[model samples]
Target chain A: MNWEFILGRSLSSAIGSDAAVFALAAIGLNLHFGYTGLLNFGQVAFMALGAYGLSVTVATLGLSLWWGIPIGLALSVTLALLLGLPTLRLRADYLAIVTIAASEIVRFVARSVSMRGVTGGSFGLSGFADEFYAVNPIPGGSYGFGVVQFSARALWVIAVAWGLVAIISLMVYVLMHSPWGRVLRSIREDEDAARSLGKNVYSYKMQSLVLGGLFGTIGGFMYAISQQSVQPDTYSTPVTFYCYAIIILGGTARVLGPVLGSMIFWGLLSFTDTALRQAVGAGYIPTAIMDGTQVGQSRFVLLGLGLMLLMIFRPQGILGDRREIALDAH
Target chain B: MPTDTWVDGVTPEPGVAKPDPILVVDGVTRRFGGLKAVDVEHVEFQRGAITALIGPNGAGKTTFFNLLTGFDRPDAGTWTFDGRRMAGMAAHKVARIGMVRTFQLTKALSRLTVMENMKLGATKQKGESFARALLPPLWRKQERGIEDRAADLLARFKLDNKRDDFAGTLSGGQRKLLEMARALMVQPDIVMLDEPMAGVNPALTQSLLGHVKDLRTQGMSVLFVEHDMDVVRDISDWVVVMAEGKIISEGTPDHIGQDRKVIDAYLGASHDAPTTPEEEQRQLAEAEAALDAETAEREQLQP
Candidate 1:
């Protein structure tokens, strides 16, 4: 068992570019669920649209990479408005139902053979990330400290992804502390009360959806750029669920919650996977009881159990107020 | 500074419109399916006075309040506030034009701190703008001003000690006080309270009454719906009585208490005026025996 390799991989994942992507995505989810009390189960749809928007605009429409960025952002905002218009007036459960269904529909359409020309079907799309790397100023070489190392290309992507994360996090922090954030929190508590005070509840909800969706789109941009590819299966239901888990695990409604949550979640996930494989190889457990093939499945089971325990014991999470976790579905 | 003159008896009369009325309602009707929840024909509220709207259960008192505050739209009617047409306006728009209201069921924004809830009521807050919210310097001074104002209101309500506490943690009566304080934060010209004393403790009822009276003394007009007749008699400058979705009578509190129609609305149409003390006692005894028999039968059936 190579302990050095496992430890290095775990450490890298704890603060790596993937952590940045998940953190940004969870921040967006926090804005919806934590701040506005909007049950947006289709966050993955916004991400998918962002991923496809950029890839299709550049690869299929033959547009410049620069144009694809704004196109992706615009597409996400449009999608948010479309989702909000019909569902904002309905009960919160309706939004949850609509979002989950909408996300699945987006995934199915992306992978369908009929739209293969634009979506690239199940084979997915690649080769559109070269422009993103062309402007990288780093020289070709390996760079890092100790057991952790990364190629110049990987370093460039990580730098940009984490940089974007920091900027967006600061923006979220500032906005949440402002009066607009107070209104969002008020709506989460009771919309009728906010409405009575002359706050346009519907319009405020719509704004929250669009802003959070925009953050999800940025997360998508980081994800697609990091992978240098886009695939329908990559933006699945589990992705949104993971973002929800990250927010709850760290703390909902806290500024740095998603940042801390993503780091810890990815670190634990990777560490467990590595530990389980090592334990299996070293014959610590019998093959009849648990095989190497089941290592991936067992890790999630453990994670689910841990989450359940956390909810029972400390649903408010590390930094959240207990009052915030008692979500008013009305 | 108006005084209540107790009149022993007076005839039931329809509402009389006041001169220089601040709010004028004309034929506002709201129907909930087959039930006409509210059918107010004509009414006027005097400026800078506290008026009490009293009715029995299902008399459409609350529904009328909703229609006037724009919480619910009337099926047909027109109303004006301070010379502005306001029938079709939205609730928030109505609030922005200096009219604010509180719910019978207190809405204190439970998760928010008491001070934060108060700050939410302040109008023209610069930080409420998304673009301006991102720039702290633009709204920070105004935010501080709002906070100071909230502090003063909290002090006035004797809620300064709980300013940092979540609004949900407040006792029922304290939540009512918080709601009233929050409404005042809007600097509203007209404050509409729905059953402000309904669930308040007897101990806090006097304080609440004082606050309502203070609203009038501060030159703000108050329109409230209340079931407690004593509270109505104590604070109201004018009384409007409704029955079956119409204003059955409107006059001084003394006249409303003795109006034949008001009494009938409370006790049912079978009620008649007693001519002698012995006859009144005999009728009361008979009603008590009937009530006792009904209770005995209910108890026997329950077990």
Candidate 2:
């Protein structure tokens, strides 16, 4: 077994592009679920829209890449308003139902054959990331410390993705510490009480929806640019659930939670996969018990068991105060 | 006893006009599908007095409070606060206009620090705006001011020691105090409390009553819904009695206690005022026997 290769591969995934994408996406989910106590099960829709927003604008409409930013933001905000205006004033469960259904709707429409001209059908649009790559200043070369080497192309994307994560994280930190974030947290605690105190509960909820959706939009942008494609299957229900897992694992309501959770989640998965494959190749585990193809399925089972144990023992997640997240949902 | 009389020379009556009225309700009514939950008509609150709204369970006292405060919309009618038309305004808008209220079940924002809960009550917070929130330098000084104000209010409520603690950790009575103190942070002209003493311990009842009295002394009107006749007689200068969603009697606390209509609504008409001392003793003994029988049955069930 090549131990050096396994360790290096694990390190690469721990802070790689996939981790960066989830970190950004989970931050948005954190704002919705953690800070605001909003159940937004359709976060993947915002991300999908972001990816398609940019790729379609450039690849299909033939517009400059810069136009996609505002277009993406507008699309996500519109979706948030559409979902929030009616449901936010009612029960919270309504929003959850609407969001999960809406996300599925977004995915289905993007992949349908009727809109193939615009969304490129199931195959999705590609070759729209040229402008995104053109802005990269790093020279093309595989550069890193020995075993943990990264190609300049991958490193550039990682740098931009993680850089965006850091900036957004700081913004969240400042806002959450302020009185505005207090109102959102107060709403999470009790909507009627916050309303009684004269905070416009509906408006705050709408704002939170839009702001969190915007984060998902940016995450989409990163996902699309990193992959250089916008496939419908890539933005599925599992995507949103993965973001949920990342936030819960990191700790809901903490500024750095999503980032920390995403890193550890991807890192542990990568470590397990690499170790299992190496062990299998070296005959550490016989084929009758487990094989190369089974490793992919087995790793997730391990992750699921880990998550279950964490919830039973520490439901508050890494950074959360048990008292805060342990609220009886009204 | 609130020696200063309210509306001198005005006859003791339901919906009697107050000399210095602060809240004027003309015909506010709310119906929960065939059942008239609140049908208050022409009730006026004294500008700077502590008034008690008393009734039996399901008498629409709480529903009436909800309508007046804009928590629930009225089917028809118009009311005003300090001469401002308030019938159609939103609850938060109503609060901004200085009429703050508390719930029967205390909502202390359990996850928030006690101090954070207090600060949330203050109006016109610059940092509360989304754009202004991003820049700390703009709101830091104002935040410190609110922190100090919250600290002072906490101290006044005897909650200063638990300023940084999560409100979830507070005892029931302490949560009630925190809720009341948080409402005061808004600097409301009228403080409406729905069953402020319902879940409170007997030990804390005196302190709660004192706080309600202090509201009047500080020039704020207090309209509280309470079931305790003793508390009503002790703290409220005036009383409004409700039964089946309608105002049945309105007068000084002493007068309300003697009103025949109010007595009938509370204890049923068979509980006559003309009963002799011997008959009253017999009735009291019968009630005690019924209670003893219930306890015995409950203990038997457990066994």
Each prediction's TM-score against the native?
0.94, 0.96
Worst lDDT run of 10 residues, candidate 2 chain A, spans A321-330
- Give the per-residue lDDT of model 1 (tens digit) for B1-303: 354233223232564667557899999899999998888888888888888999999999989988888889999999999999998899889998999999999998988899999999998889998999999999999999999999999999999999998888888999999999999988999999999997999999999999999998899999999999999999998888888888888887888888888999988879677889999999999999999999999999995
Candidate 2 on B1-303: residue-level lDDT in tens? 775665455677998888989999988888899999888879999899998999889999988888888899999999999999999899999999999999999998988999999999999999999999999999999999998999988998999999988898899999999999999999999999999998899989999898999889999999999999999999988899999999999888889888889999999868755378998888888889999999999999994
lDDT assessment of candidate 1? 0.89
DockQ per candidate, 2 decimals? 0.63, 0.71
Q: Tally clashing residue pairs in candidate 2.
A: 0
Q: After superposing candidate 1 on the true structure, give the runs of residues whose Cα lies further than 4 Å from its correct spot.
A: A1-5, A323-330, B1-12, B271-303
Worst 10 residues of 1 chain A by lDDT: A321-330
TM-score of 2: 0.96
Model 1 residue B185 distance off true place after TM-score fit, in angstroms: 1.3
The weakest ten consecutive residues by lDDT in model 1 chain B span: B3-12
lDDT of 2 at A300: 90
| Cα RMSD over interface residues, candidate 2 | 1.6
Off by over 4 Å in 2: A323-330, B271-274, B281-303
Give every prediction's interface RMSD: 2.1, 1.6
